[model samples]
Target: MSKILIIEDEAAIRRVLVKILNEENGDYIVEEAEDGLSGIEKLKKDDYDLVLCDIKMPKMDGVEVLEAVKKIKPEIPFVMISGHGDLETAVNTMKMGAYDYISKPPDLNRLLNTVRNALDKKELVQENKRLKKKVSKHFEMIGESESINLVKEMIEKVATTDARVLITGPNGTGKELVAHWLHQKSDRSKKPMIEVNCAAIPSELIESELFGHVKGAFTSAVKDRAGKFEAANGGTIFLDEIGDMSLSAQAKVLRALQENKISRVGSDKDIKVDVRVIAATNKDLQKEIEKGKFREDLYHRLAVILIKVPALNDRREDIPLLIKHFAAKVASEQGTIEKEFTDNAIKLLQEYDWTGNIRELRNVVERLIILGNKEVSEADVKLFASK
Candidate 1:
């Protein structure tokens, strides 16, 4: 059931609102207050999903009540009840964060529709918040090692800004995880974080993929499309394996970074974009630049903040923690209890060279969990974890 609060000074109007709402929907539990002051008092005591506040009231006005409620419970949708003379006030209240407004002696359809829409919006916002929390947990940084802690510190300082970040690391060192953390912790967290693997796309189509194509731009382009940069407007665009991007695409990317704009493949018209660029590469970009495979200027632009992810072997102390984390995650996914790793097993695994870094470690843990005894032993590591 939806909880609604109605605040009106006039007894007759309040009764009418309560009656209409009660009749409109049996699921709506409506409460009333004689004026704004009393309404605020009730709001402090109860959690409401929506508030229908009258513009002209005794002791306190709707505008003041709306402002106060915004500070305390801004999520509660507010619909202002406006008299003919108070229509302007109602509209102004919306600018100050009211969900919407209803003119005096509310129209039945308009009131009902507005209330329903507001409730729907509230639900959507709540769902998005829940999903964000879940995503954050899934991508959690799971080590307390000094190297990992330094990376976390950098993220905390720079995630709030729009500065571009260039993350460099060996393959499978969780470069993508760092990128996700930066975007999720930033102000643009609510917006989409679009990822493009530059190496995954063909050289000839890389430009088209990064900067969408208009219809008939190319033989394969049957419809107009928005590119990653355009799609990531008001959010972030993560360019993974950027060292593999063609020099031509690199120039376009540099232009986008410099001017905050991009042109589609088939069109010359520059489309403006507002995006935070976070790029990662497994290769040494300086060497690539020296070899003429990458642009030096573009490197400088993207490296406003540089984060180097340590290889798994370099932080072997974190291996035990990582194994436990991955074991729990894999077990949860497979609907089984997590298997414990014997101290000897963890030490034996840590001594091996992690050429594939954390990615390789996770695979080994999953294999051990599936093949080893309830408590994984050093012998289990030798049999199943051949790396």
Candidate 2:
């Protein structure tokens, strides 16, 4: 059911508005306020999906009410009610965040359409917020060690800038998490963040994968397709395992970085792109450069802000917190009560070599949760958490 509030000074107009809405939809619960002040009081005390506010009222006008409501509950959609003289003011209210406006003696079709559209928009905004929260949880950095804290500080400092970041770390050490945090906290958070794993794509196709290709570019190219760089326009693109990218692809990437433009695989037309590049690799690019496997110039371009993630053994102090977090997450996913890890069990797990880092730790925790008793113990770690 949708909750709507009508703030109209005229009793007859208020009744007619309520009657029209109630007759239009049985699910609408319409509430009335005699003036703008009373409407604001109600808004403060209760939640309403939509507000139909009059432009002129005693004590407070619709513009004032709209401003106050925006400061308080900015998400609620407002549809201003205007008289003949207030048409200009009604349009102005839209610039001030009103969803829309309806003239006095409202048209049935226009009023209903605006109300439905506003509600749909509200629903979309809420869904986006929920999905963003879920994505944040999935990539949450779950440690407080000094090494982790330094990484967090760096993210805060660099996220607002359009700098290219190169993250170096061992596999499974959460380099991808750092990339996600940078994009989510940046000015381009509203735009898409495209990711490409250089090591995963075949060397023969890596160029086309990053720079797109026109139709008939290759034997298998049936249609034109946008590449990672094109898809990430006005946003961030995460290039993982960039050390494994072929030399030819590196040249194209360097050109894109230098010129902010790319030509498709089979086309000569250059396309402009505004993108923030965040690249990560487990292999040491300096060593690759020495061996002639990686370009020296490309390395310099990508490493404007370098962040090295510490190995798990170096941040062992955060293992206990990580265990608790994984335990709750696994239980939630499996629809079971979260089992506790005894102090000794946590200590034992922390002492082991985390060759695979956080990724390995999560797997071990899941195994223990499934095979161990309700409260996992040191013995359980010994029995099931072995390499």
Candidate 3:
């Protein structure tokens, strides 16, 4: 059921609104307030899906009520009620976050339609928030080691800004996790975060993949297509394995970083993009630059904030925590009872070398869970988790 509050100074108009709403939909629970002051007081006491406020009222006015409600419960949709002389004020109220407006002696169709739309928008906003929380949980960083803590601190300082970040680490050290955290905590989290694996794409097609292509630009280009840069406008684009990107593509990426623009393959027209870039690589880019495999200028442009993730071998103290986390995660995913690792089992695993880092450790934990007894033992690690 939808709860609505009608705030009108005139008793007759308030009654008509309540009656119209009640008649229009049985699910609508309409509440009334004779003045804006009373309406605000009621709002503070309980939650309402919608608010209809009169532009002119005694002791308080609709504009004041709208501003107050925005501060307290900005999610509640407000539909301003206006008289003949209040039309201009009604439009201005929209700039102040009002959902919509209805003139006095309201038109039935317009009022009902506006009310439904505002409610639908409120539902969408709520669903987006819920999904964001789920995504954050999935990408959670699970370690408290000093090295990991330093990376966390850097993220906290840099995530809110539009700065470019270069994440460097060996394969499977969770370079991608740092990128996801930066994008999720940024101002542009509401927008999409497009990920492009530079090494996965063929060197010949990398340019077209990142910059799009017009129809007939190439044999495969049958239709005009927008690329990662355009699709990531108003959000973030994460470039993984960036050191693998071709030098030709590197030049184009450098131009986009410098000018905030990109041109499609075989097209000279520049498309402006507002995207924050977060790039990661497992290779030493400085060596690549010296070897003429990477661009020095592009490296400088992307390294505004550098975060190097420590290898699992370097942070072996975090091994027990990671083993527990992965054991639980794997059990849940496979729909089996969660297993406990014996203290000897955990200690034995931690002493082993993690050449493949967290990725290798997780695979080992999953294997031990499947093959070991209810209580995983050090013997199980030797039998199932070789290397």
Candidate 4:
């Protein structure tokens, strides 16, 4: 249900707003305040999804209320109420962060549409906040080794800029983690970080997937759709396994990098996008370029800042910490007690070759947690952790 607060000095206007909102939808729980001072008091006491305030209140005005609310609860959408003479003031309120303004004797259609749009924006904002928290929790860089520290230091230096990054590493060495870290630390963290696995999509459809298509663009195209670049405007787009991208798509990607624009698969018009590109691949792009499979110019465009994540076997000292981290993570996820790996068990596990990198180690840790004894021992590692 959406909670709406109406702050108008006029009793009749407040009643009208309450009636219109309550009758428009049963889910709308409308509340009223006689003046801006009372309105702010109510706001402090309760959470509101939207606020409609009159510009000319007796004790406090809409402008003052808006400024106050911005400091305390900036997420709530504000709609200013304006009389004929207050139209200029109402317009100014928008620049001060009011969502929109409605003239006195509100038009039902305009009022309802504004309210719906504001509520939708509020929902989107809240969802973004939730996803950011989830990303921060799930993608933590859980090592303090020199190799990992170098990657961390590089991210700190480059994340503040819009420079394109190319992350090169073996499979499962946490290349994606580095991408997420770059995005989260960057100024575009509020916007989305869209991820596309270039190798996972079919070669024939990769172009359409990166640059959207209009209806009838292909046999499967039923309607016009936006692609990852469009969706990631004002944000970051992580292209994983970019080495596998087809040459046709590579040309289009290069064009976008050069001009900051892309044409839909079937459309002649180009759409301008302000997106930060971050690409990752396990394959050696220089080798791919020599083999004529990858574009050299495209590689140069994406590799403005190169970050190579070290494989797990190269940083064996972090294995014990990783095991403990994974054990606690598995216990929390599975609703069980965290298991402790014996020192000998960790040493033995560290000595083993981890060709599959961090991804394989996480799977093995989870398996041992389930199959090993209360305390994971070297014997359990030998039994359940065989390559």
Candidate 5:
């Protein structure tokens, strides 16, 4: 239900306004105040969806009330009431943060309509805020494990500085999550964090994908295109699976890192770029470096700050906490009652070798949610989890 407050100094006008609103829309719960001071007092005491305040009242006026309300609870929509001679005051009140204003001897039609509009607008603003919060939760990192704590500490220390990071871990160990946190918690959080997976893109096209191309530069290139490095200007560019990148591409990447510039294919002009490099790989770079597949110079440049994400097997002590965290997260996403893991079920999970790490664990938890009856038991783990 929507709540509204009227702060007119005249008793007759306040009565007429309340009666019209109450009878006009029984769904609305309306309250009345004879002055701005009383209106502010009511606002502090109660939570109203919308406020209809009058200007030029005793003790305090609508403009003062509007400013105070903005400071305390800015979301509550306030509509001002003004006399014909106070039109300038009303317009000025809006500049001070009033949602809207109505002139004296209120038009019943206009007042009712404005109140409804204000309430609806407020509802939408509130709903958008709630949805954004929900989205932020879906990606929130939930853990205070020793390894997790160390990673957090490292992030706080390294994020504010402009240092190229090399994150190494097994697949699904959340190497990507760490990179994301580094970018988000960094001084460059406001800037975009562009990502390119070297393993996913074809070797022939990886150069073009990273350095862009001019129109007609290649048979498939129909128009001018900007590369990830260009797009990540004044931001961070994440190169995932950098170990899989070809030697030629790695050489070009090294040059870009050394010079802070990139030249597009079939273009002579060098494009200046300012980007923080954060690269990740599941493969052992040292092995790749030995095999002559990865460049040693590029390795040295990118490894200014090395962050190794511990695999799920290595962090078995955190299994129970991770399970509870993932379970609640899964339940919230699926809009279902959270499932509990029996003691035996948890023990069974702890014993299993999580080859795929946290990603595999999340999938396992989701499976239990869908197939397990009541509390997930030891039997469920052996049955559904593919790995």
Candidate 6:
């Protein structure tokens, strides 16, 4: 069911609009306001899915009413109803946040279709708000090492701005984790956080994946579709493994970063997007640039805030703390008492190279918990966690 408000100075026009809405469907809950001031008052008092406002009105006028309604309920869609003389004002109303403008006397079919579309858009906005809340709640950064702490501090400082962030680290070193935290903490956190793995998607499809294509744009493009940039409007996009992106895709990615616009592979028209991009790469992009595999200008665009995650081996002092954390986690998962690591066991384990970083240590901890005796000993590491 939809709740609609009709705000018109002319009593007969308001009544006619109400009748059409009621006849189109009883599922509509129709309400009326005879003037702009009264309409804004009504809007404040109740939650309406859509508002239909006439341009010429007493005291406040439709423009005033639309502006006020925007401040009050930004997501509630408004459709302007205008007389032939109100065409210019109606167009202005749309620029002032009206969902659309309809010239009066209202066409019955057009009124119903506009109402349906406005209500649908309202639902999408509501769903987007809900998803944003969920994303903000879930993407919390959990760590206490100096490196992790520095990352958190930087995120706090930079999250409110639209600067590009480039995260560099080894696999499972949680570059993705940092990217998610940046978005979740940012001003755009209330909108979608679209993520794409440059390495995972096929090279041919990467362009279509970032910028949507029209129907018949290419083979396998069975229908028109919106791309990630369009989908992430007023939001953030995390491009993971950017170093591995195809050269052709890099060109498009660079354009989007440079001009804040992108073009679908088969389309010549450029689509403008308001997206804040945070990218991650495992390889040294400078080295890739030297080898003629990466773009230098693009590197500068993405490295506005370069954060290099220290490899677990480089941060060995934090290993014992991490080991304890993982031990408790693994013990809970396995439903058994956590094995205590003797000081010797901790030292012996830390001395070995952590080629796989934090990820490998976590696996070793699981092995220790499942296979070791009452208390894990230095000998236990030798027996169960060799290399």
Number of colliding residue pairs in each model: 0, 0, 0, 0, 0, 0
Clashing pairs in 1: none
TM, every model? 0.68, 0.67, 0.68, 0.67, 0.64, 0.62
**Candidate 3, run of 10 with poorest lDDT:** 129-138
Candidate 1: C-alpha lDDT = 0.92
Between which residue pairs do clashes occur in model 5? Answer: none
Residues 141-255 of candidate 2 have per-residue lDDT tens digits of 9899999999989998898789999999999999999999989877788999999999999999999999999999999899998899999999999999999999999999999
Residue pairs clashing in model 4 are none
Clashes of 1: 0
Better of 3 and 6 by TM-score: 3
Descending-TM-score candidate ranking? 3, 1, 2, 4, 5, 6
Off by over 4 Å in 3: 1-135
RMSD of each candidate relative to the true structure: 6.5, 7.4, 6.2, 9.5, 9.1, 10.0
lDDT of each: 0.92, 0.95, 0.93, 0.94, 0.89, 0.86
TM-score of 1: 0.68
Error of 2 at 92 (Å): 19
**lDDT-better candidate, 4 vs 6:** 4
Candidate 2, run of 10 with poorest lDDT? 127-136
Give the alpha carbon lDDT tens digit for every residue of 231-318 in model 1.
9999999999999999999999999998989999989999999999999999999999889999999999999999999999889999
Residue 381 CA displacement from its true place in model 1, Å: 0.9
lDDT of 3 by residue, 1-387 (tens): 999999999999988888888999999999999998999999999999999999999999999999999999999999999999999999999999999999988988998999999989988988876664343767879899999999999998898799999999999999999999888877789899999999999999999999999999999999999999999999999999999999999999999999999999989999999999999999999999999999999999999999999999899899989988998899999999999999999999889888899999999999889889999998898898876
Model 2 has an lDDT value of 0.95
